[model samples]
Target chain A: MTESQFPQCRVVPLRMLKPETSERYLNEVVKVEGIRRMMVNGPSIPAVVPYGPARGSPNPNSNRRTIKVGDATMELRVQVGSITFEVEDAGVIEEIRKVTNAFFTQFPAQVLEGKFMKTEASLVDYCRYGPNADPSVIGLVDPRRKEAPVIIQGRK
Target chain B: MAYTPQYGPGTSIVAENRRKQMNPNYKLEKVRDVTDEDVVLILGHRAPGSAYPTAHPPLAEQQEPDCPIRKIVKPTEGAKAGDRVRYIQFADSMFNAPSQPYQRTYMEMYRFRGIDPGTLSGRQIVECRERDLEQYAKMLIETEVFDPALVSCRGATVHGHSLRLAEDGMMFDMLQRCVLKDGVVKYVKDQIGEPLDREVSVGKPMDDAWVKAHSTIFHSLAGVAFRDDKEYVEYIQRIHALRTKYGFMPKEE
Candidate 1:
């Protein structure tokens, strides 16, 4: 099949950290160092857009934040690769800190340490049928640290 | 120079002189007398009310009606008389002539039997010829017209039994049970409709997660959204633990 036949999905590079480092230490370092560097060097991230109606019942006590863009609703959940930070309203920055902390905690003494090289984020739209909502997404975001190509030529 | 008659004298004398020159001893042997039985005659036998007698009939033709079996043996018929009769009857059916109604059916049958009309031989050739003649006979029979006996030539052997009849029977069964049944079209329509409705409503829940994950550069660059949920976090943790323990890394594409 030709390339045109396939629907393009995001592909990104990831760097996993050693397990010796502490999550607390990694999270502190990432919030101070990593986020600052990305904000300074990289382009600004796009705004969050809402997708659709909430299908399931929202948690009563937990702050259920939903952002609306057009016909979509956005929900926030905190994930850190392997470790999750149960932060209230843990937006994109907090989510990044959690992932960076997990990475460093997982891998400690590597040159490309304490952070993932890249990641692919997809915007899923889900439908609610009673308490059970199906998980489906539309747009995708793929971010990666640029890598230099290594060239090797045959000696004639 | 002037031409002159080579022989000069009476005409009979000149003729005798030419004969003598042609044959020196023209009448040497004396004539012999003929007996009654020795009187050989040309066109001798006379038939009644005819000028000349015809040649006598052959020995077989002259033989008596109840001639001994050994003396006048009959030709053994290769195929049974009944079979020939049936073939004749079949030929006289409505299947006579190159009609479009049976063309497809016959061609399919021929193909199934690996019979090529262009290069028919052995029994296949014979069967095709027989079938054609039978079709013609059928037409004649339908029109109530009698035809002369058809000459049977040696044809190629058509292997296997009457599979055409069996296939026809199967087709008939299919037409009755499946094609002609009610609600078949509706059932097919329903199968197509359900999938379309289900597809439109897909993808609502995952939209929320995407928005939450990529809200800022920190989350997007750090790749934290990959493990945004509890299940994903657990899965990643298991992978990390396994990798740390085994010194194995996730396979890179």
Candidate 2:
């Protein structure tokens, strides 16, 4: 198995971000160049009560809503816990670190360098995206989810 | 000399808080005031003013069994009235919420009667007769055991205990049973995720300092570290060693 040449890092804040905070943070981070692909991950706030007696009832959560990032408008299904992204090079990580540092003044955040993104597509990915699917789209969205990944046309 | 019970073993503030909660003699400081009607609304078991739906006839109206054990153990009001069994569950945040699952179970067993507590990694559920459950639920919500932000009442989908708190410091509830508005936390939906007819205000979230001090869970980053408490570690180690040795029946040295 071969690994992707691009480096990945995750920016974890001490507190999970509200939708407004997440949008602001994303907008700021996208301003920096060399961020290839990004994903916002956290505990999901379902559109409807998923289980128990109230299953199928509408789940009205303030945290779950649509937010605009650069030229893209996407719905946020989860409370933003951490933002993970694949960058073009190691230098981009430093630029992101500076951006995160300046952004998270109210609370501390860490820019952890590791292999956070899937280097290779799994069986689930194959089933969801098919054999000739774009490598960039792999592992971006949950396989169970029918929703596709959002493309943010950033300034850079 | 008369017997006395030591609730738990620890030197840290978390341990002391745990002991305080588990000791019936140690009165929990009342932090909020949630009315009995509010609790019923949040519980979603029955209407606020409706009579308790019974599972059986009242004990007084039923024939008495000639048993010594039955004679000795007096029935609680709910039991005597034959109220249906109902439950209330709580999910506690790992970030210095006042209590944890096991701690809740232990504390409930010590302080309340006729309760069946189910303890999990992140959530605790207590089941009792509907009438008794309302009284107990009211006490749990209005006392120091509850924090409007870190602690939430969730009957199902209790998935946010170990996750990071939201930017506003409220625990993540998938159902969003409660919402923080204008410095106050209000329950817009019942514990089971059904929308409430009217919002039930449980008061504002406690400050970080108060939560840290009153918290029973030992968190390394947020609150007191478990390793910092030597006595607690020693006690746990001893128990671990004894439990392991007991299986083998080793002779005492």
Candidate 3:
């Protein structure tokens, strides 16, 4: 694929410190009618308490709850680390920035510009989901795990 | 004989910052005043005003082994009180945060005693007597070594050190333990990401300029790279050469 066909997303990484803040940010950003697809990337919210004395217990992080993104109701698998917006064009980047700045202005949130995700499928994508899988989903695939991960909508 | 002690070998600002922290004589500047109660809440070890849970009977109650080493080394207050060993972990952002795991370990080893410190890629955990941990934790939290946005109070889900910082200059926490409010970063949950009863304000993160200026980590992205520091690179080369060459035999001759 040519460089233009490569990841064209003008990434406005809205990195929030807290999951609730991130969840709120996600809810607001998705509502802004700007351009193309938007996805948040961050460290995964583990299914179990990964370590310490409470290891193996169900991770009941409140911020790991499902959030409304436009019309779609999606469970946030990871604490929304940073939100990447794939605008239809560069025009909406400024609009999204205005909405984000109003919210993140009090705190230390930044507006970083770049191509955050891969537009093309990788070896892992082929190994896990196959060739016909959506390009958007390719970037979302967990690079580490090939096996199916249980996606729980509600915290157990 | 009085001999000058060297902090790590480096010529960069990162190296200078390391020396400032490692030297006990150099007082760490206060960054914020997170109340003692707020600190306890964030730690999630015990409740405010609660008695410290003990692991064993007080030192006074235990029979002394006639070892002279015991007499020479005075027991810490927490040990005397039989306080449980508790730990506080910090994950410093790699994007030029004031301190990182190795630097943190080096500083703690020099300044504190009767402690056990564990260093990982992004996080550093120090285990000490409960009361002592609290004291050390306070110093660590209040001092320049910590920036609420850059250094996370993470015990379990400490995955965001190397990750790109969020818009607000806060480290990425999957658990979302802390929130950046009006101007302060508050702990909505404990270090391990357990929900707290009340919000514990850790204080606002340092501005970008301050965080960058005080950071000890050498990263090409934000701060000076290790390759650029000729003396540091030479020191590393010298150490590696000596270890490989003389490891087979103590003396080259």
Candidate 4:
């Protein structure tokens, strides 16, 4: 297992602390943020996701609308012996940063140094244009489109 | 073929002849005691080896009984006919008595050697004794008093045994002696090396000093916002403060 296989999130070193404690602290911070899910690199899984009640319905249902947080379908990939994250949701990128920052801030004296690096394409690509597509809803158009513009969101 | 005459149908001829030759004066008697001379003659006639006279010395003359064996013997006192009597030897009462201190002393010796006294086999205990000289010296040092005779014999009584000034002193002596003899200490040592004398004030956080020491690190890190939102900034700060105040640093990396 290469280090790059798991998405390397910027983490502050807390002196002499068990890895489990840091993981737990990070988890708690992410949970409180209403951002229910995120992902860490290995196994290419999503840590969290929001499942709407109208998921199967043509119209959105209010009752089943719930946000699932944390790694769900994140996979760790090794490229050139370096661990890389295959993130399912790009939105979780911000949450990972927040959790990492929060963890370091809790023990600033222990943070020797840290760095943030973004790499690898996301597994999930959101389509911006569809049958009922609103121009405002469309973000990025697919670069490969030759005819009509196909807007898509690439996860981080 | 020529016919030969058969014997008489009635055996009167043979019977009549045997009766004519018979002498009816033969007699038999049971012998109560046979002398050496009689035995020699009997052997000389029956077998060649028997002719070589008996080599055994004459039996010792029996002494006249003070009371007749029949009169003195109580037939019902012992086992019944065909029964066997078995003798079982036990340790001397002085050694085996419940009140005897030897068992306790021996057990203590075993404990020092790291052997459980109750479970020690005889051979193990004997082995322990061979290795126990150093234990004896240690015991003497801790005890502050010595009596070789106390350990030498089972029946020797201890006189005027007094309690030592310090209980620890006594226990230490016992432990030392046991280790010296047995090569192991069985009991747990309870004493902490240093005395805890500082007065712990009520309502004060116990680890306040450690928290204060790491406050700079906590404040700086806690101030950073991973989420652009305002709520997470406050939450991270609170977590930082709480951990700094009360949580112990993890022991391992």
Ranking by DockQ: 2, 3, 1, 4
RMSD after CA superposition, every candidate: 44.8, 1.9, 6.6, 43.8
Location of the lowest summed lDDT over 10 successive residues in candidate 3 chain A: A147-156
TM-score of chain B of each: 0.11, 0.98, 0.96, 0.14
TM-score, prediction 1: 0.13
TM-score, one value per model = 0.13, 0.96, 0.74, 0.16
Report the number of the highest-DockQ candidate: 2
Q: How many residue pairs clash in each candidate?
A: 41, 0, 5, 49
DockQ for all models:
0.01, 0.89, 0.27, 0.01
* Candidate 4 lDDT, B1-253, residue by residue in tens: 9964331111232222222212122121111232333222211112213322222321222333467874665432111121122111111111111111333333344334322232211111111221132232233212211111111111111111121111111111111111111322211110111111221111111132322221211122322213443444565688899898667665656
Model 4 C-alpha lDDT per residue in residues A1-156, reported as the tens digit of each score? 112333333332323222244334534544532322222211111122212221221211111122222442211210001111223344444565555566555443221112223232223323433344333212223323443422222322
* Highest-scoring model, TM-score: 2
- The TM-score each candidate achieves on chain A is 0.19, 0.89, 0.70, 0.26
For A3-95, candidate 1 gives per-residue lDDT tens digits of 122121111112211112222333343343212112111111112211112113221211122322123233322111132211122254445
Error of 1 at B246 (Å): 36
After TM-score superposition, what is the CA distance of residue A4 in candidate 1 from its true location, in Å? 26
In angstroms, how far off is B8's CA in candidate 1?
A: 99
Clashing pairs in 3: A108-B168, A109-B167, A109-B168, A110-B167, A110-B168
In candidate 1 chain A, where is summed lDDT lowest over 10 consecutive residues? A37-46
Q: Is candidate 1 or candidate 2 better by TM-score?
A: 2
